[model samples]
Target: MSAFDDNPFAESAGVNPFNDPAVTQVTNSTVESVDQYNPFPATNLASQTTPASSSPYQPAVLQPSSEPTPQATATAAQANLLRQQEELERKAAELDRREQELQGRSSTGKENNWPPLPKSFPIKPCFYQDFSEEIPTEYQRVCKMMYYLWMFNCVTLFLNMLACLAYFTTSSTYGVDFGLSILWLILFAPCSFLCWYRPVYKAFKTDSSFSFFFFFFVFFCQVVIFIIQAVGIPRWGNSGWIAAFSVIKLSKAVCAIMFIVAILFTICAVMSIILLKMVHGMYRRTGASFHKAQQEFSQGIFTNKTFQSAAAGAASSAAQGAFQANN
Candidate 1:
């Protein structure tokens, strides 16, 4: 102490505390203790969570691409999707049934087998027809027959005029004959013209079965009467049957000409019968039978490409709207 006391620093402490090798270790321990004992939550948390050599917050590793958590959510969503799909399918089936019923009802009396009837129009009353397709072909066939009948009657009128001209021009002898024949031609010309227009008009305006029967009846009887009159018979359709036998004496040439005219009229009558058969066939093909109409309606308009597309589009839009509403 006598030697060391010679210097004041030696008395204070033989060395500087900062220069001591153990001082750094002591300082570090103090810092750690201070952090652990911190009143601040952040400092306490950092001290408790961190390792000596590591950061306070742990860094997560990269996850595998095939994470199963999302799949679990997806599976639950798929179940919901399946339930929605079944509901949509049920609605679609119901819609299809309704459409079939509407189509069937539109065409046939089988409407009773359909769904409930529709109510008032959704839009304005005058906006749309809400119309349906249901035209019976029998009526159309009748119109077509009337058209054909008119055409044929006009053609027959032309032929009748030709016969009259031919009879006058081709005759050999004419004393009082031409004058008598002239009077006969003048009188009957306008009357015979009625055969062309009247029958066609009757067929068009009136579809009475009795009228058709009467036409066939009266016209055929008139033909026989006219034939007797051509032979210069005093009374037609009478007990004077043999009187018409004198047609043989009517200049064999004229007799032959008249017979040819009768043959032409016969051809026209046959043509009308053929046309009647044709129209009847077309009518039958138009599903005139109730069962046939129902079957055709079931498959025809509903299955039409335009209608199918419209139905599909409507269904899609409706489903989309429902999904949006639910969401």
Candidate 2:
């Protein structure tokens, strides 16, 4: 009865489950581990918080920027502008120098070479002539031909004088022809050069309508004179075909010479006609007109220093006379 009445799960007062050898061993080990383990250690905390060096603490300093400053950038831009301005000024100076050189060459720099006389000779060259420099390439051929024609005419006149001298030896009545031949040579050579040749040269150089018109008038007269010389009129100071034929009875040499002169005159007339046509064609292409020529003539007259001085003097005299008359 006593054994059945006692509970099977009742704890025994002296027996503790926690006081068992295995449980006591586990509790002792856990207590020792809990004491040894520390979440915050002195060495690890110091390594994390402190710097590697032993130097004193200082404030952080900012390094200089690699980018250019505003002032520096502005200075660079100004320097570039100054350099450009200097370059422009240098170029302007060069252009001015070139312009001055051109003006000098065009006006007074070059010396006269025409009439090509020696330095030791009494007479100096009277004109400057450079077809290649002053005249256009298209007009050079015509200009040179005209110059050659002038030279040829001079030669013909000299030859005519010789022929006339020979004829004079044949008869005293031919003295007038010899004298007139000398006169013609002396008068015509310089006059032709000044009147027709110079006018044509200036016309080509400047493309002046006034010069062109002047050349046409003078050269036309020259052509007519050439035709008259070719006609060989007696006592007219010409060695024409008739004069040449007449001289044949006197001296065959004189006749031959006069015939050559007559032929030269005919050639001059024919060449003048052809050249006139050519010049006229060129003038038409140049767009020059009578109105332009008139303007140019008037302008030239007004701009002439001699004309201006004369006009001023005349006005002054007229004013003085009127004032005296009124007084």
Candidate 3:
């Protein structure tokens, strides 16, 4: 019974399988290998596998962009030049159209429209005046104002004649005033139109220095004449301030009419001064000078066929007379 209870396979007291050298060595080796080994290593397998002649692994880096090529820069410049050429061509076409329009107008021999009289009237229009066609857009306003001023002056002159006629009725001593007023209306109206007004118009239209100078000279005289007319000196023919007040006691109706004429004269003087200043300012802006005026005047004289013919006839007549006298 004792032998059966005691087994041969059973371990002795204090002797453990786990404490054995072989088992302990195997377990320690496994733990040491686990501690030393690393699943994620810093070493590069590609670098190690590659041959010595191959380059080492490196990170990709972004490079700075290179400058534009000369051909590409030239292409951009050519595009700009082409755009400028197109603009120049467009401007040239516009200028050609304007020239053609001007030529067409001249070639058509357009009828005069100024004075705007009816076809039934005996006196035909003497001039063709179109502000829209002739005058530049920038100068049209001032030019139109000048035309209105001329018309106003004409009306004032006509009123002055009427006033003088009434003054003559008041007294026979003022008969000369009435006569002179008629002469003034006949003379100054046309003279003023031809002299200062026409010169100024030509100045603005053609930008002519000669025309500008002529206008300045003639308009200054006109302004002086206006002042003299406003003064209304006795026997001067103008029914101005002095003439109006002189007839106040004789006939109040005549005095009132003369006073109105005097007022119109004063207004004319004021307007002339204002327009003169405005024209002077515009002249300064236009770069007009006495030298340019002289050159333009000489050119105009030389270019005129009438002047050339007169000069030639005079020269020939003078030579023939001298030859005859010598003979």
Work out the TM-score per prediction.
0.25, 0.67, 0.65
Residue lDDT tens for model 1, 1-327: 677657655534446667576886677664557447757655557556747556676678987877569879899899999999999789778766756655554443454321233555343221111112322334445545544554554454444444444444544332233344344445544443345224423333333333333345545544554444334332221112232233347556544554554554555456556655554454445334445545545665675668889999999999999999999
The list of candidate 3 runs beyond 4 A from truth reads 1-106, 314-327
lDDT of 2 at 111: 62
Model 3 residue pairs with clashes: none
Q: Which ten-residue region of model 1 has the weakest summed lDDT?
A: 124-133
Steric clash pairs (candidate 1): none
**In terms of TM-score, which candidate is stronger, 1 or 3?**
3
The TM-score of candidate 2 is 0.67
Candidate 2 residue pairs in backbone clash: 232-240
Worst 10 residues of 3 by lDDT: 98-107
The reply for model 2, stretches above 4 Å from the true place, is 1-108
lDDT (Cα atoms) of all candidates against the true structure: 0.48, 0.87, 0.86
Indicate the TM-score of model 1: 0.25
Q: Once model 2 is optimally superposed onto the true structure by TM-score, how far is the C-alpha of residue 280 displaced, in angstroms?
A: 1.2
The candidate with the higher TM-score, 2 or 3, is 2
